[model samples]
Target: MIEVLGENFIIQQIRDFEDSQFEQTFSGIDKATSNIKNIFESLANKSCKIVRYKKFKQKILNRKPWVDHEVRDLKKTIKPKGAKLRQEPFNLELKCNFFTHAEKL
Candidate 1:
């Protein structure tokens, strides 16, 4: 096995052994690089690891129903009176009107 192409390449750094030592010459540099790549990939496959984790499921909630027509109409009526009361805080008529409409709820 060629040192720089196989698993122990980093320790040896392919020292001392000459280019003359190996009898096989690749047809081109690309083929030589591919053989080294294959050896590295095989070693990586043996050492690789996998990890998994659980995902949190958020709680789903049902939407509340909107106010019905009669209650909606009552709020519309009362809202203007309450606004007028706030503008004239000392007005007895507006205060009384707002309270009377509010109690109809």
Candidate 2:
């Protein structure tokens, strides 16, 4: 009877150790998953910024001709009023509608 009790105690101890190890492993995996999620989020933000800059640049380039014409018209209109003619490069606002729509993911 004593030998049977000793064997049962050893079996219980081994089961407990296995359960502890499994819990530790699962916790480590959760931490790794969280870290990966953060890294991906940072990467997504960088990509969005790059795309926004590219689109802003393209729009400015497209408007070059219209901007020149508008400036010429403005100068002609203001010349009779004795106003000084001035021209400057304007920064265009690039709306991230697509990025905002996809933010849910």
Candidate 3:
């Protein structure tokens, strides 16, 4: 039988049929807890790295404001031929279209 309470409490009712029953159950629970701890630690580390990188990128962007203007000018100057491409404000769509067309061959 399993009993769950609130958001995190889980109680399993195990009838002892042999001497090894309690040891097996507790061992399994210990292994599961260890695995969960490892996963949480890894995810936390990855998220911290992502946040650090974002902060670093924001600092760099702040230092070089003209970089954005140059990129915008470069996008306006480049255009694909043979397709009636609508004027997209961002270059992402155009880049994706270029890659898709290249993949067809």
Model 2: lDDT of residue 15: 55
For candidate 2, give the lDDT of residue 40.
Answer: 49
Worst 10 residues of 3 by lDDT: 9-18
Q: Count the backbone clashes (under 3 Å) in each candidate.
A: 0, 0, 0
Estimate the TM-score of every prediction.
0.37, 0.24, 0.24
- Candidate lDDT scores, in order, read 0.65, 0.45, 0.45
Q: Answer with 1 or 2, whichever has the higher lDDT.
A: 1
| Candidate 1, poorest ten consecutive residues by summed lDDT | 11-20
lDDT for predicted candidate 2 compared with the true structure? 0.45
lDDT of 2 by residue, 28-78 (tens): 778656655654454455444454343443345444555677566665554
| Backbone clashes counted, model 1 | 0
lDDT of 1 by residue, 10-100 (tens): 3343342323244365555555566566655655555565456789898895543866777778989998888888899999988888888
Q: lDDT tens string, model 3, 60-90?
A: 5343565666565544444452243455535
